[model samples]
Target chain A: MKDHEAVIVGVADAPLINGKVAQPGSALQIVARCAKAALDEAGLTLGDVDGLFTAGMWGIPGVGQLPTVTLSEFLGIRPVVHDGTNIGGSAFEAHLGHAALAIEQGLCDVALIVYGSAQRSEMSRNLAGRPATLTMQFETPWGLPTPVGGYALAAMRHMHEYGTTREHLAEIAVAARAWAGLNPAATKRDPITVDDVLAAPTISKPLGLLDCCLVTDGGGAIVVTRASHAKAQGLKPIHVRGHGQAATHWTIAAMPDLARLTAAEMASERAFAMAGVTHDAIDLVEVYDSFTITTLLTLEALGFAERGGGGEFVSNGRIAPGGAFPLNTNGGGLSYAHPGMYGIFLLIEAVRQMRGEVEPERQIANVRTALVHGTGGTLSSGATCILSLD
Target chain B: MTKPHPVVDPGTAPYWAALKEKRLILKSCRACGQAHFYPREICPHCYSDDLDWIEAKGTGEIYSYTVAVRPAGQAFEADAPYTIAIVTLDEGPRMMTRIVAADADAVEIGKKVTVRFVEEDDLVLPFFALGGA
Candidate 1:
């Protein structure tokens, strides 16, 4: 590795659910706290952060004005690099990649990546008044509404040809919940069985309540710096060896295929090739769980399992702790608070696992490398990053 | 006539208007002779600005398909189990539309279909159904 490969040395995640932390904070406050914690974990102060990377085009559009601006003002330091990407949820991974390239060029020593949102409230408010949810406002008129509905439509097609079933989809959620049970900060910690998931309330046909992810207001962050800088500062650096992104079509309606996420598959292929690792070589996996079927389908797309065999591979307690593979150990978006920012959480969990600070039981043994994937906007955009310890 | 049903953007107004009134429209480059749908101003195949809207025979085959077993969002809960297919039009462009005369069970890849307009808000949307049916 070069002296300045973008390396994530330290990471800190704000507790997802309300507990010992201060009660009732907005998404901005959550972002500030998480950013603060990430810097602190690196044994650095706010003043040490030279660059700030923000995700999603939202919460603010005009330059020099971001919710990050308020946080920056509170710290009394202007950032040299302010990157705000609006690719739905894939912005963080994209930001991290961009940050890495910038760090290689001596842009900044410490890059702060943070995101938080009140998607639960925003979605509810929009649905109560608007004819369609904001996500589905355009396609819903043509009868494509909600992420689950869109994905369920795709999953149903998979079932038609590949015989994938609700049980197969449920197995993904069940495995996620089992991993969540071992997490202290998970919003839904109790274990769930495939049968329990299948019997859960139906949000959409074949995709019951359990198949969908949670929606809550929360934030998470990861701090990156040149490897040598972090090493000179006495922090262990997780090398950014692999990163790539792919998008098939802007709208789901125009895509040539539905049963598989071709973009995610392509992105993962690029990432693994960049990282020089195979599916079996990866010790930890963090597949985005916007919906249960997403995980199942992504597992297959990422080559973790064969086509239509995700259900077979994930069933029978195979993905939980002590199982074949450890996935979404931070509870994922399903059990973890989704907070409208899934990419940030995936990197955060990967960092925590690699740092070896997670609660012991939830921690996967001998995790030298991790694969973190993110999906944005009805699987319209996707990117994957491989974080490895050398 | 001006395009109706909200496909009236500067780039695609002509295409949507052509799709209406029973015309399958595609952007045919006068210089390149390429045909495509969900029309864009520049040809993805040749990047040409010289293009015209040409009427199609409204015949195509299913490239791929999905069944919406779960009705999601607020507007689609009533339309559960609808078949949405990405049909490869005879003009060589693929479009997303609901396929009629084919149930969730009957839909298959490469199945022939023909464009049929469905009216919404005084707007005619080009839908499709089994070609023989």
Candidate 2:
């Protein structure tokens, strides 16, 4: 690796008791705890951090305006390099790329990317808090549930055009639960069959409760530095091979195509080109699973399956544990802790898999390369990263 | 609980006003000759500020839809299981709106639809119904 090549040195998730934040949980407190733990694992202190990156839906109205400033003041570390790019859930994946660019350009040597959310504890996970303003004014007044309704609409279109079924969508949830059964940190571990998924109360038509992600409180952080620095410190580094992020539109109606995730296609194409890797070379895959349709669309858009073929691609235990493909191995947002924005958890799991740090049964064997993707908003934004242990 | 009311601004005022008059209007770009929704002064199609408002036929097709078995919040509890849909208007721009039908099965992709006006307090909202309804 080049001397200034960026590599991840440490990663950690904030403490969770039964997948919920232990009381006294605030977004700031959780983020700070994760930041400190990640730094400590890297054998560095807050003083060593020259770059700080964060994105979240916390301290609403204020942090929405000045997230970097809020985090800097609370963490008590003022950095010359800081970024607060909030493009919804995938913000941290974008931040990782930004941090890598800063490191390679010598703008900063050490970068800390962090995120935290107490959406469950605060009881703010629903659409109740949203106001009818701007683009939302058109959607909210109609009683359309934010996010979930948006995804269901996409599911309806996909089914109409390609003959996708609730059974095909249920496979995704079953796969996630199977993985969750092996993960102690996962919020839901009970084995669920496709029939169970279909039988669950429908949140929105075409999407049952099992088709949605779990809501909890959680935080995560990643520490990045040059490969040369990590080598000198005798740390095993996970190379940040490539990253790309893109967005089409914020509202579901404005999406260029309801059946396809155009942003994921753009983001993953760039990431794969940069990494010089093919789809077959990837040992593991982790993508945002805010909903089952999100995962189905992402699989097709990422080129693992042909457009409209995700239903066939993920069928019959294809992505479950000991299956042909390993996906969302941390149980994913479907069965893992969702805590509102779920992009940060994707990175955390990818890094752990690369380092062989996960529980024995859950770890994939001979895993050398991994791909992580995050989808944010109502199928709005996509950010992809390719990481390697080589 | 009352459902949310659209927060209107100068750019969207005319569209809402037309709805109050029981007519649907769309901003059509004179340059590209393509129409758009949510009423923007600048045409998203060709970046032309030359735009005109035209009366929509109020007839469309259900591009996609979802029945909110659990409503958004208390404001919509009474309307639980209401159908939320995206209708591809005859003018070509797709819009987010409610699909009002006595039977949930009446709503489906590709179904012909037409708009109806519902007045709530000071506001008039546009909702769709199956053409057969």
Candidate 3:
């Protein structure tokens, strides 16, 4: 299959507040702000945005229905091409491919992909408070924690089958915090150690508080256009080299293998093949880190390390500062703000790194290529994209 | 005192109904000769509507599990530090349920288990205990 060539022209992130307590704002307001900032970064206005793509309302109260249509109308632009592909956190990464293909096929010119959430400020009581549904009929009745418990199951299985220990998982958190320390925009920048991660209170077995990503209130947006169009607009173009997405199951019960993430394997392979680059050539990796275990599994699934060797791969200060492989330079979801869906932020950070927009302390010097990956829905779905400066 | 119960939908009503009789059943796809849990009308493997409810021996092995040191929600508060597991049925299907043992930590991967009916209020739910326990 011939790869569609589109370029990321602009990327912007909304101000991420700790918002530990429920804040007083809506998803629409935050998303609109992010969209405008991204457009301004690209030197484009609402009139130039012919394509608009977004995910669901993310359970924000009074956001109305249909987030894509609602956000478009709110922005005062009627996009000829629109998409609302909600595949959990990987939605925005998947949209990159969707928008790139649309742009290549002349379906739209400047595609704006946006996401925002106030999950931390809204609190769990206001959001995700629903009556018993299908999941309740099967899994939740057994007290399966929606995500933490679901991910813990996978972590337990990995430990059982691969001898992955808690310390190895803690290494990921420690490394993420180290990276976050250098990022001014990161919500949690305090230095932490593997011991701190292990000592934190356990939300689920093998998953402590430190291992989890912070529930933050934030938004992010990206603009994609044809490579030629980006050059014409005089914007720094980060070429969308390749992209792929896949899902194994919806519920944790149906996950084919708890120890392995097949979707990530499939998606990364397709992406690597499309980008025509091996793991050695990529300068940085930005992976979704919902939990420390999530980052480990993604690394293994993406072939950064051997299948069960993800634990060993992240150990010995490998992913930390000055490590050979720079993982999640912008602190990632673990240390950075994770407002519900974090896929868009992955692209934003990748673009920053490629464009040399980050601080010298945090940026990877002369970064030419970046691989951004997102996992959603209990490690059931995965999306991979390779972006390059050349 | 009451416990959490499964919400019976049109697709899963029969599975819950069979539990009342202390019998375990799952939808077996006649077309693909496969079985699945959390019953649906169509076959997940082959997408065939040609299916039938078959009695299962209720014997399986613990595929994976986690000991919830903390309750997942309010209803499970009483069961704090309980064991939840995905049991791979002998009939070739997986189901999520609790592992009832004297020590939740004793539950290990690949441990053999069999279904045991626990009654909470008017609802009967299938839980798993160590095989031969």
The model with the greatest DockQ is 2
Chain B TM-scores per candidate, in order, are 0.84, 0.94, 0.91
Q: Write the per-residue lDDT of candidate 2 for residues B5-87, one digit (tens) a residue.
A: 88888888888889989999999999999999978879998999999999999999999999998888898888787888899
Residue lDDT tens for model 1, A113-176: 8875655544532311123233222244455445555666566667767878888788778778
What is the DockQ score, from 0 to 1, of model 2?
Answer: 0.79
Of 1 and 3, the candidate ranking higher by TM-score: 3
Q: Clash number for model 3?
A: 2
lDDT score of model 3?
0.85
Q: State the lDDT at A252 in candidate 3.
A: 88
Q: Which stretches of candidate 2 lie over 4 Å from their true place?
A: none
Docking class for candidate 3: medium
RMSD of 3: 2.5
DockQ numbers for every candidate? 0.24, 0.79, 0.59
Judging by TM-score against the true structure, name the best candidate. 2
**Residue A82 in candidate 3 has what lDDT?**
82
- Return the lDDT, model 1, position B124: 64
